[model samples]
Structure formats: C-alpha cells, structure tokens
Target: MAFKYSGSICSDLDKIRVFIDEILDKLNSIIKDQDTMFDLKLILNELVINGVFHGNECNNNKCVRLYLEVIDNIVRIEVEDEGKGIDYDISSYNSAELKCCGRGLIIVNGLSDEFYVKKNKVIAVKRIN
Candidate 1:
C-alpha cells in the first residue's frame, strides 16, 4: 500500500512547517527511526521553506505545492512552486564560498540522502523500512 500527502502554504514559513509536520506525523508509523525521521523532516522543511522564501520571495499570496509519496519503502518528496523559478545555478558557485543567506538549502543538502532540483521544484528522497 502507498500514500500521498500534499498541501499548499500561504507563503508563510510557519504555516509551511506545520504543513510538513502534519505529513511526518501521518507517516510516523513507517518513519519510526529518529535519525531518519529527523533527516526527512529537516530536508523537507528546508526545501519547502526555500521554495517559499527565495523561490517565491515570501509572497504571502503566492502558494507552493508539496507532494510526498511512499513507494517501495522510499519516501519521495517533491516541493513545487509557481514563483519566479530557481534562477541561480549552484554548479557555478565557488566551492569555497557556496552558502545562502538563511542556510536553508545547505542544511537540506546535508541531510537528504539524495536530492535534486529542476526549475522551482526541489525533490528530497529517503529510504526506510
């Protein structure tokens, strides 16, 4: 069996965090490992917050879509937004000074087992049993 979790945030960071916490709570049965749970939570939070903050530039009226799917014991999360879209290319940034103002994506990249970005959507994935 599989499940899908999705929601839209009012361009508000707190609301977005709550939106994610709700999904994590629902998936608690499968995500019992604290470390795995923390990683998933933090990664999703950071990416979603980034999409809402930098991608959409904190436009409260604008909405961001978050989708989480469980398949083959892998929790795949895709956060989508209709903002200006990711303008920068992390690949071009210098390795020595690669950092963001809020350090949101940095935390996400560090925690996620695997993650990637396409346009304005950032995908975070984790495998759990």
Candidate 2:
C-alpha cells in the first residue's frame, strides 16, 4: 500500500502537533514499527519547527508546505517555507558544538538515511523495517 500527504499549513507552532498527528494517523498502517514511527515523529517536529521559527520567522501569514510519501518500505518527507532559502551548507553542520540551539538539522541528518536542502525546501528519506 502507498500513502501520501501534500499540503500547506500555517506557520503556527500550535498547529504543528495537530499536523503531525494527522500525518501519523495516515502512516500508522503502512509503518507498524514503533522505532520508525518515533523517528518519523521527531523528524517531522524538527523540520516543521525550523520552518516556522527560522524560515518563516514565526510569521503567521506565511505557510509551510509539506510532502510526505510512503511507498512500500521507503518514506520521503519534504518541507518548504516561504522565506529566503538556506544560506549555509547542511552537510558541513557540526552536531558536536556546545551550543544549545541549531541542532535540528543534525538530528534530522542522523536519523534520516538521506537528507538534503534545496532552495527553500528540505528533504529527508528513510527506509522502514
């Protein structure tokens, strides 16, 4: 079976949880593994939070576009924001820094099988068991 979700959500922090729950509901049947689901949830949270805080600068007027697709054992996630594109290199991000902030991309990169940023969109791919 295949599942997909392509939609836009307001850049409101309060709506992120509801959006994630809806996505999880859609993915429950296709992804039965608890660990995978947990990882996906974390990934979604990080990406959406980044889009709201960094990309959109917490602007409620802007919207974040999300694309989620699960085909067989592979799952793909994409998030796009309305603000300017990324300025730095994502691959060179240092997760070991002693800072308290800016670890979202690092966490997403570690959990995802493949992660990349293009323009205003960030994409992550994971293989489920």
TM-score of each: 0.83, 0.92
What is the per-residue lDDT of model 1 for residues 4-121, given as tens digits with 9 covering 90 to 100?
8877787887787778878888887766778888788777777777777777888998888888998767888898887766654545655477556536655666676677778788
Task: Show the colliding residue pairs in model 1.
Answer: none
Highest TM-score model number = 2
TM-score of 2: 0.92
Give candidate 1's root-mean-square deviation (CA, Å).
Answer: 2.3
How many Å off is the CA of 19 in candidate 2? 1.1
Q: lDDT values of the candidates?
A: 0.76, 0.88
The clash count of every prediction, one per candidate, is 0, 0
Task: For candidate 1, report its TM-score.
Answer: 0.83
Pairs of residues clashing in candidate 2: none
What digit string (tens of lDDT, one per residue) describes model 2 on residues 1-129?
688899988988788889888888888877889999999999999998899888999999999999999888899999999989786476566667755455788889889999998878999999998
